[model samples]
Target chain A: MPERPGQAMQKSANKRRATVADVARQAGVSVATVSRVLNAKAGDRNPVAEETCQRVRQAMQTLGYRPSQVGRTLRTQVAHVVALLIPDATNAFYAAIAHATETALRERGYAMILCNTSEDPAIQDEYLREMQAHNVAAIVLLGAVETAELRTAANSDTPIVFLNRRAPQGVPGPFIGIDNAAAGEAVGEHFAERGWARIGCIRGPQTSPASRERFEGFQSALAAAGKPLDPDLVEQGALTIESGDAAMARLLAGGHRPDAVFCGNDLMAYGAHRRLADQGLSVADVALFGFDDNPLNAWLATWLSTVHVPHSQFGRAAAEVIVELANHRGERMERQILLPFHLEVRASA
Target chain B: MPERPGQAMQKSANKRRATVADVARQAGVSVATVSRVLNAKAGDRNPVAEETCQRVRQAMQTLGYRPSQVGRTLRTQVAHVVALLIPDATNAFYAAIAHATETALRERGYAMILCNTSEDPAIQDEYLREMQAHNVAAIVLLGAVETAELRTAANSDTPIVFLNRRAPQGVPGPFIGIDNAAAGEAVGEHFAERGWARIGCIRGPQTSPASRERFEGFQSALAAAGKPLDPDLVEQGALTIESGDAAMARLLAGGHRPDAVFCGNDLMAYGAHRRLADQGLSVADVALFGFDDNPLNAWLATWLSTVHVPHSQFGRAAAEVIVELANHRGERMERQILLPFHLEVRASA
Candidate 1:
């Protein structure tokens, strides 16, 4: 049988964890002295005696004493945790964003609790309530839907940053994201420049702000080229590869066979690519473009032309805003930050 | 300009959050009564009066009061949070495991704090220390290397579950993983049955137990069939797509041109496929096999024959073990749970 640390210390069946008090007792010093030695706050004029500090360190090492962050958080009334609410985990776009955000947050001494809501309103609300109830230091919502419960939670003391998504009007938080309309317009320009007459589009849900913006901008760009939108060529996807594939299949099977198609995101593009290939139709014949240049685009053999939304930049920018907001809680500051994006034209288009 | 919540709350320029005391005051009840009503513990014969309960609920709603979990945890000495440490987030294999683990943990009423170690030992150590300090409910380490600090942490009171990785001997924790050797042997049998000679292998670092086991089992199986292993045909990869590509390039550029190759994981296999395609060597000519049948296998056009480890099952089993150990902290329980695996034969083989 493995001997637990608690039991190892007890020398009996009864087990308990070592506390600061135990370390203090072992070091023959006050709990405050031990804490002072351990914390070693900067700018403190009076430092602990070297011998006393050494004794405390030795005592801690001997007792396997690890200071409890829970106790510290209780005293400070601020958790060193940040809750990241994302729509999906499998999507490479969100995953890359998460990776970047986690890296940035770790550098700033904050642990990230990732919540995959999967576009479920109930799950999003539940996670929001939990983050608020836990008093997490900050909350970052990436491509999340706005709800009354979320708006109410936004009124709490916990700092909030909207990453790749904007909260409802009147909500206070920094939203760091690319201008989707501009990116969409760039894609539209690419298609028009390529002289593709019959165009099709696969957009995300109507409720999604980013999707709506992209669709509107694409329409505006096409109208500028004297090509009004064709309702028959438009389809709504659930922002998934399967949905993209189905949408592409519908377009291919429909009367209006478009020579070009722009997907809402890269995953959808992959789906479109697969579906097109399955039907013996090639991406070269139907120029395919996607949004969010996820890492898969660079790795996969199918080079998808995409509007690159610098996910790492968004992560770094959101971290900066959230950390700034956390440091200046209750102080008015800029609550919106828009980043730049580029159109990466690859062989697929 | 967004009207900040702090300013909105402060009609008279002084703002504060509504607390339990405020709720109790509004409900005309004791704090303890409100606590009991809110908690609603099981088998509590003395339930709060229906009218009082309604009043308390209404008070809570009107005040927008959210109970702080920090206070509850301080009192209860346990957090409703678990930490999942992964070596890489972008790797589809680890991502699938993370997604599954997070879903299982969510079902069990535990929030998951994902730590992306990125295969950095320093980062891993820092996260381990942070998880221990935070006193998270439990810690789930996915494919972590054994270290003295980790061993010490394993001996702590927190329930730990090693998922897809085995701890060194005498480590106090439950390890949940598939029998890699058996899985590898299955792959070897497939190769031998196909009468494939000149078999090359790309294994992960020697430090990885899974890699070593797979390589060993493959060698053993090949030797059992009266076919001795060729040391020159084996190359150690970094378990990445790029590494696999480089390893494949080396094999093809070298004198020994193996007709068949087994990669450590799917990412590496993807890399090898890309390199082979670039070199005008089709997968059809050089049979390629991989491990970890992640979601990408189904999405990608190339069907890769690989060993399926049932990642979701591994996650569920790990959660079960961790939850059980947490509930029975000091009790002697099963410390190891070995899962079964099978070889998934796809077109690439």
Candidate 2:
């Protein structure tokens, strides 16, 4: 993913100030090497030869280049900035991850620029472009926009670590998350053990791999238990309370209401619970299960039984992965770290 | 306040590339004028004189200066970045505000950097320093650290707008929020109407102005109604569920279980509610009033009757105030904009 020398120089020359890219191009070295030479810690051995370091330093002087001083650490030449992109900040699940990640990053001497794309592809692309311009050390993505632009950006050399998601097909990056399919299977197993014949599920958008996997796993597990999911009971929501409410209502109106229902997330569960309550059906009458056990769900007067995915661990892992990637001085290795998830039994289901 | 010419030049010359400050000093003009000339929009009347614009352009050329392309808009010298500093992101009240503000800013072609200080003064100081380094256009603060650094920074030229908070005495800035005292009085009146004699209150930390105001108003209203708050019934918490739970426990152990209780915020109410439930004391047995009618309260089976401060409005107002200040090229103005608050009567009280 290293930039072509001609392309790097051409882009830099077009600007009045010579960027880090310009120094790399002029010194006939990679951007990483130039960064290391300029920002090397006192005890760290120089990866580049002394003469080569001098050459890079001289090129920087000749081009009037200055390292990004705003968030740049003089010792490591790494920007003190990290960008955290989430789909929705208002969602407690993502908010918890963000809060944990920000705390972890700050502890590591990095300032995070938290961006909420609100699940929009265009905004995601725009924020990625902005991050590129700022020369951030790394980016941690809690959600992704699966578009050509995202695919292109992911293919680039910018160090990225995704939380709760894998890089889309054709893109390359490390990821840390729970096994969505396995978690879904756990829900199915639980329902089958309770001998619930008519089961319903509300899924997220199909574009999300996590959502797709969850739906697939749940269906497969039910099929194995001789009770395949009824198409009429299956509904899709956009992961909002309103969507969940509407989806639940649709499921009920389809002639057979599920004795027990599984929601894609805790927010949807809350919505589904509300819809049931509105229809004079109590949670005790219809068992409810949810994924992503946000703290709010447990604290509610009526707690939800859900798949407890450790969001704090997901966030801390993301920070650690990015830090490792940023410090790596050679070819990048692809990693996929899976965290554990368990079903939390509560009163609702 | 414009930087002194000598100070600007000295600061810029220490780096390799000449900054915007360097160009302004060389052109004998204010940084705002230099910014305006370089990033002028189509059909917008040039703010600087033609001759002065020429001098600025020449200075840029001579010094090889480049504007920050990462998050900067060509139409305004302002960086496209705005930092929203919140005390806690996990708290639904703050999360709602953060979400609304981010949406508003994004619509105005600005990206938001959300920072969670976790209500720690040290972290607040660290974040403020980091924001200063990143050169954000404006900062909307949902919380503030009462420190000398914060006081000094407020007096600087960086446009700041306080949301749901007032600038500490010496730190002057514009603010947008509901009248906390009035909202507290409303909660008190509601309790008074119910004719609850033994009213216990759980207040947030004394350092929080919002918390202090709420306690004062609630106590005064009770006195006005010929019923005064018992000194033994009062407890202090950190506006958290644990704090609320412990405070409620203390009230019960004091051999005077109140017929009703008031919490400074919804989070504390949730805690107190949980504790009462644990003791087999249903909310129906004891009326509870909470400030900040967070959506969670309504979603819970036992709803909370509390003051509803329009969080979305508060967020939008913060964005508008900053946008106005950014667009104003002349002197800065300090204005206190008060929004309305109302009682959202629900089931718990």
Candidate 3:
């Protein structure tokens, strides 16, 4: 029986395991040449002959030697690791973004460390500290953060990128996300174009830039259409299903029922749909508009009209910018990249 | 401004930051005393005054000293990290599991590294090698690795635990999951009791042990109830929403169109529901059963009947075992722990 085949083979092959010196000796090359071959750091510096490279490869195969990634990372001063911090990993929108970002990062030979903050700033700070301690190559933040604090903590050396949210002035990082103001304007125009006059808005938490931007855009669009802003028609809640349900209930009880409703996100829209259903009112009775065209929003039972933000594109763009920043940390940084959004007209609105 | 108040302050205040020597100096004791204080090392070879312990704590606080987790882990042979290899992060079921596992591990002071394999064996090997190289404290594998070649490479001093799947015999790891066979039997009995004589099963892929056990249990239950196993009613696919939709379409196309369907997971069940709705079939008319009572299953529209596996408990138990092994690497290991599952009867069934 091959007891511990993997372990025994590795142990018995060579007691000390092949080092750069051993490979150099076996391949009849200098230690520097062996290091260059193993680390892929030669890069037009003292290029080796094709025959010598082949001999080095053969020597490595014979010795069963695997180069140390940690050592290489330290020597290069690049960890090849990026940290992604999201408010919640269970949310489909964020999960999809994380999936896309992970694929992009992997293609670029980088590993991602996923941290779930559950919308708690303390947890976010802890994760940020941990990432800094690990010397993460770059960071992609998906949720809102206090601008001054985040900017101070991030400093200039660490490349930071924002996704689904915008950073404050002078943050020195690229922001990749949908044009929230445009999305909100589209929703407002859709409601107006459909001749639904009375509109109520359920906004996300006040701290989020996405929420604030959308609210401003919606208000501006309504004003342009000669409609006065009704404070009684607005309700504020967290961007969660339960919060949405609660906000909708409050709107219903306040006696300012509108014929149309615009929600901050799809999860909230689903909650509003359920609440309306519970009240014996169908979604068709009140036109509903949601943002972030998540997968669940397209279900047959709930064909939600939503602003389709290109989630995958957002992720890919963020990854590309961060990778560039990682390559050149001290260069002048790009400010922001606003991706376009489309309106998915479904039966709901 | 407090520059990097968390860890950086401590590192900068003292030239070398909180080393074993610094701790000893503050405690008015030997270097070994501080090492014992941090590691909780066994054997009390030195005695220190209670006042001295207090002074040590005060000094650490004043200097903003945080112990080097890396150094302690190195000396104690405990990395304080666990690697979780998941099939996919986009799947809500898997995401929920990963979320719960991460929370559990974090509460126990263990960091989790989530690696998405995308159901590829080669990628799984790459992640396994990365984990081994990091000297992760333990590993929790969520997918099946059939080939002995890959298994042979997993020989490490770190403990490993299998989740949602069973490893081959003599594999050096504990298996933590529900009794899939029993859950399937329960599903079969539920279908039979509900008077759905004609039933179809959207079985998972054959490579997974959970799928095999579930199929066996379902077949055994049907046989005991005098219902012959109908080969035509079975459609094989992966445990994904798209696969479930394809499998359902196949079943409908076949001559045997059962009134009820049992899906391998909740995502698949949701897909089945979507397909049925597209075909103008009401959920109430055709009963559907799913496994893993995911949070989304409890939504009003998708009140899916499912087998409730304590996912959080699974994570907690796995972390506990890993922490135990990390603390005592040489101790005799426990082989397996089977968790209990319950049937959650909802509107679908």
- Predicted candidate 1 versus true structure: per-residue lDDT over B221-314, tens digit per residue: 8888877668888888988889999999998988868889989888788889989999898877889999988777776734898888888887
lDDT of 2 by residue, B240-335 (tens): 889989999998899979999999888888889889999999678877788877866656534787888888887678777777777762335567
Query: What value does the lDDT take at residue A315 in candidate 1?
Result: 71
User: In lDDT terms, how accurate is model 3?
Assistant: 0.74
Ranking of models by TM-score: 1, 3, 2
Computed on C-alpha atoms, the DockQ of candidate 1 is: 0.35
TM-score of 1: 0.87
Model 3 chain B scores worst on lDDT over the 10 consecutive residues at B1-10
Interface RMSD (one decimal) of model 3? 10.8
Better of 1 and 2 by DockQ: 1
Tens digits of per-residue lDDT for model 1 on A1-349? 2222332212113346678999999999999998899789777788999999999999999987878778878777777888999887777778889988899988998899999998788999999988877778888998777788787767767767888867777876667888888888888777778888899999988888889899889988988988866889999898888999999999998976899999998888888988999989887789889988887776664488888888888777877777776667665454557788898888889
Give the Å shift of residue B292 in candidate 1: 0.8
Positional deviation of A159 in candidate 1, in angstroms?
Answer: 2.9
Best-to-worst ranking by lDDT:
1, 2, 3
Q: How many steric overlaps are in each model, in order?
A: 0, 1, 0
Best-first order by DockQ:
1, 3, 2
Per-residue lDDT over B1-349 for candidate 3, one digit per residue giving the tens place of the 0 to 100 score: 1111222111111132356677678767777666556545356567455576677777667754656544544455455568888888776678888888888887887667778888788887777766655557887888757555456544555556788888765565667888899899988887777777788899888888898888889888887887856889988878877888888888888866788888988878877877887888866767888888876765533578889988777778788777766656644355567788999988888
